[model samples]
Target chain A: MSLKMRLGLVFSGALFLVAVAAWIYQLKEGLILTNMQNSYSWGLYISGLAFFVGNAAGGLVLTSSIYLFGVKKLKPLAKLGALTAFANVTAAMLIVLPDIGKPIRLYNMLLHPNWMSPLVWDVIVLNLYAAAAAIYLYILMLPELTGRLGWLAIRVDDPHAFSERWAKRIAPVALLFAIGIHVVTAWIFSTQGARDWWFSPVMAPDFVSVAIAVGTTVVLLAAALAYGTGEKYQEAYRALGLIIFMATCVHLFLMANDLVIHSWYGNAETHRIMDIAWGDFGPAHLFEVAAPLLGAWLLMRPQILGSLPRLLASSALLIAGVFVHRFLIMPAAYNNIPMTMTPFGLPESHWSLPIASGRFLPGMGTFLDQYAYFPSLVEVAILIGIMAYAVFLVLLAIARLPILARENQ
Target chain B: MKMGMVIDLEKCIGCRSCMVACKQHNAQPPQTWWNRVFTPGSHRHLTPPALGVEFFLPVHCQHCENAPCEKVCPVGATYHAEDGAVLIDYERCIGCRYCMSACPYGVRQFNWEDPEKAHARSEYQEKYHYGYPEDHRHEGRLVYSPLRPKGIVEKCTFCAQYRDKGELPACVRGCPGKARFVGDLDDPDSDVSRLIKSRNAFTLLPEKGTKPTVFYLPPKAKEV
Candidate 1:
């Protein structure tokens, strides 16, 4: 047992414990566990699900490398990307479970679905994407699985012939499945209709670009952690860092174009939300504009923040920024039921519906307000559990399989 | 047996009586309702006293001849029956909320939790579909009718459950102004059928061609 592996196990185990405890408490309490209600039908859980699903685009990003760009040197990380996509998607599904009124009956969506609803389309597309991504990941893993099993025998001078032959056949076919997952997921968000921001013509490219940015961030962070255990995976880390930089550039370009159009022709309702980019949500504003700018800035001088700790901090910033982008983008396109007045010109009544009805004020106790959806302690715990669960699985696979064997080296 | 509706827009005061009546009769929770009043295209920017609100469309499911909700339901939970009334089999509903999202008019409502929270005991017992089966009327909780469950999709059934029992729909019966007309669209002499024939009527989003059976009277000019 390597020291790096031992430490990974401990950290993951602690997170897993906290997450399980929180999730159990929430399950017992229903959706009241989160700061959610009828008006805000979707809040933290849905947003988190969207981001996690977006992260599955990492496999598509990797396919672009070995298949599109012909970067054969980056081949080893392809499976890592697939693993990350699968883990994130699985985690996303778990988050959705407790978010609904009755998690068990989520399938009734298929039974009673209105064909026109974009929310229904999201479910269909997400399920298809998940299936495709899983198949893609498994196809890539087949050879590796066979290789590890053979190694277990080879070290003792015994080997199986059929497993090696089967492994050789499946590798090429997995590539197609990889591209399908991200493209389909992109279509789900982009094609929702007239959501100006999400329904933009540049959605497909934007989806791929952001996924690559987040995906590489995940890989780079993984490699950085590997370094503390003296695994010396700096070359791999740098390779992922470069991908992150390029993807960040592509993502920023799409955002710039989208923002320009919005600035020019955005409706009154849209301007109210987009103003947050420059308004009092300073940390969020900084995360969206400045953090990425600083990320791009750091790339120019990698020696400054390229070390393990700083790299982690920057990766955290990138994650936070992308998340904020999802938060704003999802709620950004909503239509607020405007306040009405009496015929006599007096204010008639305040309105209540799903989107804008929540009463929120900005302060330390902001979470109690209607619009203030700070993930409850249970929500945070569940999220932490999911992250830890993914990490635990990855570490266990590495420990058990010959994932980073000297044969590859 | 194609039962349907024709609403006289001129008489619709937007008092929301029909909506309130639907909620009360159906015993729907305060927030969950099958019918809604949308006053779209407010002529707020129009010159004063020029019919400031363009129209009030009291909308529910059209019980379309070519229903989009029926086609998209993966489990075959919602379907157009032999009588042409769209029906939902609640026993299989997963409540994915697809129908609610898909209906352009947004008529579908989720039973987000148990229906009891929204229904008083007397109301839930009296008005719930299937009426707690033949034997379970006194039980504290009734297994939801085959037409509704926590996870399954639900929408306006044209009050098919009541129509089957020779009762006027809760909404249609409870309407105070008699502004709403419901009858067999197949029978030319049915009051709603006659109403549609005399009025310049249209369904919302007719361009989508769902061919909704419900019709609305285009308000005609009246002497001041």
Candidate 2:
């Protein structure tokens, strides 16, 4: 293995170990270790899940589009995008495992699933997408898989013909599943009538638009990183950068529309959530807007978009911006505590006790008090570990899988 | 028949007897309460208010007819029971806490730690007692246990155990002020139904459209 690969494995392994330790501790103690309170139930983990799921969309769209549209120039990059999609969707699904309060009882989701719940729909769609992505990746790699392995050589007479025919047939289905995964996830939040921020009509479309932007950017960055600034890969880099720029523009437009509509005639709850976003969490909002704008500007310059290093940096910024956007969306709405009757007096005589020290304790008077949530140390560690694991999975695939096709083909 | 409660905000002294009774009956973990009493006017706890709204408002699971929490539960862990009360099936819960987020009233609480450990360290340990023992079956059905295991969502069950025995909810029976009335909301002659008709009762967050069964009678000026 290369030194870079060796170092990456070691780093990711260490992170995975730490994550495991944190999860074990959480399992022993329960979710009390996290900063999530009754007011803000879903926190960093759900946001991470949403972000990663969006990241998976780029690969699916790119690879499926390549097949369906017969984009000859982008044909060589199809496997890379498909593999990235497969890895990311798997990572997205895995990250939520630790966030579940009863990880062991997760099977109940399938066994006694409530069709009315958007989460159940999300689970089904996500799993179907993952399966489709995997099959798509495997079908794309059938030639290598069938030829290299002796046992597999007997199963297929012409691997190339088999892969070509199968790939053509599966592209449309994969595309549909990819779009469905993101829509279902967006619906999970939007369906909640109580959450004014999430109940917007623009949620699903915005989710798809942003997902395409981030996903394509990730693929572009990965391609640039692996293949370097060679003349052969320049066309792919420029094409992806153009796609990212357009998608980011759409995402920004939708964001503006949502903000305007929300502020124009929304309820008091909506105004309160918007206030929190623009006030206390202003930096995150600004970063979400500014980073993509910067990336779009860079993409307008042909020279910068064509160059590998510049394209990689621009893509990185866009991806980070979308992530911040996802992070901001998840918790901002929950900060508006629901209407409750204020206590006649403090619940306890003393406020010095550790339990009573919470900022929005029960008897703190008003039900509409500002609620704050920041992921605790253990949550941060687990998040870091999940990211590292995704990196490790990508590295593992690149090293073992026939992801990079021969240039002549 | 739909079971529900009618709380007289006029008579509530904010003593939190309902909260204490719930804790004592359910033996919930530290930092978790199925019921809570809130003072309305000020943001700071115990601050004397100029608004003259001195009455305390005790809030718990409203047991809504159109429950948001029930609709959002992925595993059907939370469901509307036969008597219109929302209950959690602990064994089926995946602990995603979607219900907690969906609940506009924020009545649900997740067991962040083991109940045994929380009970041991709790200041109210002396008052804690299990309403039903673990693995103790009653009449061929597993008795509802007050102690919840770690990592599951829990909330008030409307005292289903007491309801099954034809007794009132612990909170209603324990109220020093005798301010709470529980009965069949569908029954015309029931106290809750009669109070809702005669007293100009109001439900919390009517805009949410949860259709909460709990009704509140506005406090009189003299009471404040």
Candidate 3:
């Protein structure tokens, strides 16, 4: 086996082992292994869920380049990005399974769904988006499949097959569908009026912008990894950096806007959450603030980060920034000011403890473990396995199929 | 017919016995309850400290006729029974927590972990046992001792189990202040029915259109 294949197998196998170990520990001890408690039910799994969903947003951006704007240089990336969407949504779904108490009976969500709940709507949208994303990528690849497999698309191949014509013809519509998938995902969270943190007019756009930034970053990383034998994918890499740079600017603006809203509103919940972001939840803040700032600073002068090493480092930093951004948008939204607790400056005698009230506070440990959900080693292995498998699958499809036009010698 | 609860804000002593009784009867965990008491925000923050931090409102799932939670559930897991009680099917919930958002009153709670670990005292056990006819003791011990399962949403049921037995909810009987009044809206002769008729009762967050069944009678205006 080649070195790349060997590395892929080793990486996948190691992740598999760790995930399975975590799963077993969680199953035996229940949620006690994790720190998730009553006050904040959502932790790492939910955070990962949001991150993965956001991660899929770039596939749409890639689709737009090829189908919407007729940018042919991105044709090589369309199938690869679609495959990433599939891998990500799958990872998100599996992570959520262990997060809930009754992972065994998860089917009840579909069997007895609550129509009005945003969560239920989320379930519908996630599944639909996954299906649409998968099909959109596959349909675009049909022509490629027919050219290479011969037997895959149909038994016999005609050079000018009608199916080939249809595949190219409808590719634009599939691209549009891809854009809808992530936009609707943003709406699901934004519509919740109770949590002031999530109630933002720009949340949908923010979600789309960051998705493209991270997605393009991942594409660049993958391209560099593929060219390890010293080949240059310079054109695609340059385009990727430009896209990331622009998207990073949008992403930063959105973050500043959210803070501005919180300060301007000065409501109890909003201000309390702002305090948590700066004070107790400092690690996440560090990631969100530092990574992007450094990434942008390093990449700000394109000439310096133009080389492969600089590009990879910048991508890594940006990816970390996006991860912290995911955490900010998710778990932090659950902050509340318990009406039972006396306002901080109140007199001691006036401290009236209510007979019954729910108290909200910052939970301990990595937010993910609190729900008693530690992603099982099996889950992590599967996640790593799927990602490796996706990379492998995309590479094989691209190499063997006509996903990219044959280059002249 | 509208079945509801009337709480006299002035009479509440905030002893939290009602909260305890709710957990005891419902077998809920210590940190979790369908009913919670809220001491009114301190009026001391006002320009003058004349107003006192007077009343504590005990709240639960209002069993709203126009419940926001019911409309938002994608799976239709939360719904109202014919007798005007909001109900949940524990076995069916996916724990998505969308209902947690739809509820403006913030009553619904998601079970982040298995509830059994936190249920310290099993008061629900007593209600399930046999009790006397004349007194609440006639009812049997509360059979439901198990805490709520994880990955499902749970809230107050207005003691539906006790209602099925033609008895008052545990909190109604447990209130030492004698401030709670629960009755069938269909029965005009019931004391609660008369209280609703005589007193100017108001539902919290009525503007949200949940049409909450829990009514409040603000402290009677002080005599001039």
Candidate 4:
């Protein structure tokens, strides 16, 4: 194996070990280790799940868009997108397993499902999307694998012809599933009418547009980094960057629309959520909003967008922006429980009482009093492990599998 | 028949007896209260001068007819019983805490640690017990299960197990001010039903459309 691959394996392996340690600790101590409390029950784990699922959906959407548009130049990068999608979706599913309190009873979700629950819908659609993405990836690689590998060549007479026909048939269905997965995730939040922040009808569309932007940017950066900004791939990178810029603009527009509607005409509950987002969470919120706009500007500049280093930096910033966006949505809504009087009533005094009297514990507090949420050490470790695992899978695929399409083909 | 409660805010002195009774009976872990008393209004303190007409509001699960928490449970761990009481099946809970988030009243509490461990370390052990399978027994069954495991969401059941034995909920019976009343809401002649009719009772967060069974009679207007 190459030195880069060896180093990646070591790093991811360490992360995997750390994650296991964290999980064991969590199981022994229960969720008390985490900062989450009765007030903010769905914290970093749920937010991270949403972000990772978006990443996965974004990858599939980008690949499907390539086929739909008949972009011949981008065809070489399709395999990379498909592989990323499969790896990311798998990682997303794994990340959520640890968050479940009773993982042994998790099968009950499928066994005795509640059809009305958006969570069940999320499970059904995510599993279906993962399956479709895997098949799509396999179809993409079948011809190359059969032709190159000695064993496969002997068994298959015309793998190339069969793959082409099958891929053509499955592409549209895979695309549908990709869109469905994100919509289901968005619905999980939006369906909660009790939360004014998530009840907006624009949530699903916003999720889709942001996914496209982040997904396309990640693919662009990965391709540019792996295969230099040479003449062959430069056009493909530029096209992908343009798509990212467009999608980012749409995402920003949706955000602005939601903000204006909520802040201007919305009820007191909605305004309170806006206050938290623009007040205590101001720094993260500002970065989330500004980074994407700046990245779009960079992408618009021909010289900057063409340079591999600059494009990678811009994409990295854009991805961070999207992550912050996902993180802010849930907490802002949670901090806005209408009946909780702390945030609006007496600010400093009541906040200190719960903490001083030891009634609140370390992380526990009225939702109205505090909005600060620091992910516990266990949560951070688990998240790092999950990301590292995703990186490990992608690296292994790139090294062992026929991921890159041939130049002549 | 639908069972419900009517809390007289006018009579409540914020003594926290109901909270104590609930903890003792349910064997809840430290810092977990199925019932909580809040001094509503803009008053910084609970003093008589600071409080004008507003009184202490003790909040618990409303057990709504259109319960948001029941609708959002992915595993059907939380459900509405035939008797109109919102119930949780702990064995089926995946501990996703979706019901906690869905609850507008913030009545739901998740066991962050083992209830037994919490009880053992608690300073108030003399007042409340917290092992699995409570000391009290009914028909040879433990009044409260001892195995109150961590990582599951819990809330006030309105003492359904006690109600089954033709006894009042611990909170209602323990109230010194007789501020809390429980009866069959479906029965027109029930004391709770009569109280709601005569006293202009109100439910919390009517805009939420939860249709809460827990009614509240606002404190009587203070004389000048």
Residues A207-285, model 3: lDDT tens digits:
7777777777776666555553133345555566677778878877887887788878775556666777765577878
TM-score of each: 0.75, 0.91, 0.80, 0.91
Which DockQ value does candidate 2 get? Answer: 0.51
Regarding DockQ, does 1 or 2 come out ahead? 2
Ranking by DockQ: 2, 4, 3, 1
Question: In model 4, which runs have C-alpha deviations exceeding 4 angstroms?
Answer: A147-157, A340-368, A406-409, B42-45, B48-51, B120-144
What candidate 3 gets wrong by more than 4 Å, as runs, is A24-29, A139-153, A159-170, A228-232, A278-283, A286-290, A293-306, A338-409, B38-52, B101-106, B109-147, B184-211, B220-224
Pitting candidate 1 against candidate 3, the one with the higher DockQ is 3
Cα lDDT tens digits for candidate 2, B127-223: 5566544432223333246677678888888877777778888999989999999988889999899999999999988988999999999877743
Give residue A230's error in model 3 in angstroms.
Answer: 7.1
Error of 2 at A122 (Å): 1.1
iRMS, all models: 7.7, 6.5, 6.3, 5.2
Candidate with the larger DockQ of 2 and 4: 2
Error of 2 at B21 (Å): 1.1
Give the TM-score of chain A in candidate 4.
0.90
- Please state the i-RMS of candidate 1: 7.7
DockQ for each model? 0.15, 0.51, 0.29, 0.48
lDDT tens digits, residue span A37-139, model 2: 6667788888988988998986676765587666567777787787778777877887788789889988888788898998888888888888988888788
